[model samples]
Target: MSMGTKQAALDGVGRCSRSRPQRQSGVALLATLILVLALTLILGNIFYRHQIDVSQATGSLHGDQAMLLAISAESWARDLLASDNDDPEVDHFGEDWAQAIPLLPVDGGTIVGCLVDLESRVNINNFSSYTDTSLRAERSANANNMGLVKLWENLLQNMGFVVDESRVSVIVDWLDKGDELIGPAGAEQSDYSGFNPPRFPANTYIADTAELAAMAGYSLAEVQRLMPLMSALPGPTTININSAPEPVLMALSGDLGIDFVDMVLDNRPFLTLQEFYQAIDIRLMVGEPALAIRWPAKLIDVKSDFFQLNLEVTLGQSRLEVKSIMQRGESGRPAVIRREITVVPAGVTTVPSRSIDTDDENAADFSGSGRDRFSDPDEYDREYYLRPICEIADSYTTGDLDDSGEQF
Candidate 1:
């Protein structure tokens, strides 16, 4: 009986030991599974953050590359202007400097650039009354002082935009030192104070054309239309006959018509004032009554000193646009007066092509003969003011230089 009892007790103790070990193993396995799952979650979060950081860094790099490309294009434009300085007699669309840059392939991107003559357009600052006695005297003496206002009116009308005479007067008031209101079209501090967010008239000269939008009554659409035909240069500058658009040419004188503008453009890049006069005489002999009036030689010139360069660059998924105003010095080298940079979305395919079709029905009928001359030109050909950069490159490669220092 003692032996049987001892054996049963030993068996019971063995069973208890085995059962405890099995329970301990199950607990250890559950803990291990929980630890593994926690570690996986932590690692996954870290990996996701790392991927995000890498993507942002790549995008930043692309943006930097795009900016550099735009800056490089501006430099190239300066060089082109410098080259034109050698023969400063004329600035015309036919010249190499007026050519637009085509899409050029670069490292991880493409670039497009173009140069526009600021002097070709009317200077808004021409109305400003500066402390310079010489400038003041010129403003009073030159008939073009009023002529500029007329020119702006003509340009707006030609573009199918209703000219706001009051707005125009306000611009004139802004320029003149005197506080006297310019008839019904002018504005002063009183007019601006009436706004909910009270604003004041800029009594001084404007630096940017966009500032015109801030005027009391001007619309954004109207300002945008005027931007291409107007500039805000520091001082009074003569319009470059060679580069001036047909509308601007007509605005030079109310007597000047579309036919006269076409004649001037057809025989462009006039080497001297005498040459321009000779052309006018020829038009006069042909019974063009508009040509009978004396051209305002003092208010116009054959060359330009100020130009604007627009550059667009794409790098990977990033795009950048740069606009720079360059002023040509006596040495012919252009100095950057202003520069603006903007970032656009990646993969934007709005890069302007080599040739832009004038299919837009809204385009202004430049010819004022009450007919859409742009559709079909009989006597006057509306020439392309901006040529493709590829064409200019080809001209250079082929050494196709004409008497006017331009490629045909």
Candidate 2:
């Protein structure tokens, strides 16, 4: 072979080797870019999850702090009510404890709340007397036993609900410790089983007004509407005429017309039951004498024993609401009978200023634990024989009429 031809072949082989190396370098560069992209995506996902976990943990911590603040506020309320017992014979909106706890800045946020007189509203548990079969039969035989039932009927009418005796019967059946129906509208486990997701009747005194709405013939809206005027106290309690809403005062007796209610409302914060009676004597005299005679004197008083403390605590990102029921006996020291707490959502605001709501039992989140002290009121020897101030004046002692130990 010629030397020139051999040199040409060697040059061609060198060019081919150089081109192969360039192609391999390009592939390696692409692979390195792909690896970096995959790692970046993985790290980004991890960082995002960590941020979410941190946020959730922070929220939980804030909620715990808010709850503690709310509990502390509850203790403060108990003491306030205890001190107010110096004049336990009278509890009215004009009193110090009735005033609201204004929004006060705390460590992390703010706290606000107010006290409610539970006695100012009708107690649904008053009808639990129907649970006793013998008593039920006896009450059924007497028109006087039907006084509370009639009052409830009137309240329903005032609240725009259709007045049905069955409505009251159903509520009684829910509270009665019997499987037998109280009336045509009464409900039992059998009736409850017909629901989509079956529910059973409580068959005992309810701790929450939500239970009242759960019964047949009652709606959530109706219960909410009545929330301002009704309570599910541990037992039967008299209405505090001093603080009762106009609707409640009107419900006390069918004869208590709006004009009569106005008289009670305008001159109220009555210092004594006698004072309340005097304020309405003029109207009572003018009304039908028979109806005036039946003025439900037994169902009312000027003082109260049951009160509710509603507190709202806000800490950082968390807002908590608490409701506590307190029972103040003759000793005058208030004891918590029930408590409930709820976590409110962000971006929602409730009236921070204090206002009166009949009972906290109306809240859907009624998860509280406490023992209730209950004493059934004495049954009247004569059902409709309720008397006013003049009749009781001769027998009424100065302190005998205090609500803590009141007989009627």
Candidate 3:
């Protein structure tokens, strides 16, 4: 070996040492990158969970606010109805209480509500008072039953639904407190046994009109079509002629054609039952004898006892809908009989401007024209507060107010 060979060996050793450090540095960099990735994943998961919790808390807060606002609106409606005792004999669209609560902005979002006369629609529960079976039997024997049956038939035909008298019989059997079938067309427990989920007829008043879909021979679609014109009140309720829709007015008698309904609506807000009868005679050119045979006075009235308040409240991302039924008596404050609250998707709604188009030939159309009676929000809000003291005084007799110390 010579000196040149030794030098070559030294160079090889240097190259080896340099390559070892480069490999180690590469491994260390890989480890550091792996550690960073792991920390990032863990932190991301924690942040995501925190975000979800915050969203849930915010939603809950909004929901609570919406509920409270709905309750306040319901109280307002009850008070409005109670204060309407000044003209307790009539409930017309022209009345202050009948006005819709025009959209009003609130602290967090907005709220809108309206009062509807439930008596304007036919009451399916009117068939049976949900009392003793004997009373139901007695009512069935009365002229009102026949009149109601006729009205139901007329309404179905007008709405383009298949008129099946058997369906009416089934409803009758369902409402009656008796186990006996109404007729061969009626459904009893035996008829319902074949249903997908076997059930029996609720032999009592229905809390909601949706129950009508469960009856035999009726479909959900048919019930939906009839829902706008019908109600399932707690007991027998007369149809309010002052606020009844044109369809209901047309259903009142076979003799009442579209022209007659238009005339009746044109001369609206009948002050008394006698005034309504007089309008009928004047429009039909027929005497009370013909009217008596077709229409039953007991089944109709100018006043309403049951009113429904439909309110919508919004708070942040939450939207809530509330419906409350109030029963107004001849005296004292109106009481809330039923209440329903639901959470819906968040969104905004636009309230259409209301104006009575009297120049239009169809101005007497009840559905559209009647809605036009609601004034602006400012006007609607001021109505209750600005009511005359004399009107409040009229709510009670002088002797009663003197004794109760409730006089204004």
What TM-score would each prediction reach against the true structure?
0.74, 0.74, 0.74
Model 3 steric clash pairs: none
Q: lDDT tens digits, residues 40-146, model 3?
A: 99999999999999999999999998898888888877777775443677888888787778788998799977787889888998766433344345346644333
- In candidate 2, position 100 carries an lDDT of 78
Q: Against the true structure, whose lDDT is highest?
A: 3
Q: Report lDDT (CA) for all predictions.
A: 0.68, 0.69, 0.70
Query: What TM-score quantifies how close candidate 2 is to the native fold?
Result: 0.74
Q: In candidate 1, what residue range of length 10 has the lowest lDDT sum? A: 365-374
lDDT of 2 by residue, 28-52 (tens): 9999999999999999999999999
Model 1 segments more than 4 A misplaced: 1-17, 83-86, 129-146, 177-180, 285-294, 348-408
lDDT of 1 at 401: 28
Q: Given candidate 3, what's the lDDT at residue 139?
A: 41
Cα RMSD to native, each candidate? 10.2, 12.6, 13.4
For residue 35, give model 1's deviation from the true position in Å.
Answer: 2.5
Q: Residue 216 deviation, candidate 3, in Å?
A: 1.7
On the 0 to 100 scale, the lDDT of residue 45 in model 3 is: 97
lDDT of 1: 0.68
Where model 2 places Cα greater than 4 Å from the true spot, the runs are 84-86, 131-146, 183-199, 285-298, 329-332, 348-408
Listed per model in order, the count of residue pairs whose N, CA or C atoms clash below 3 Å is 1, 0, 0
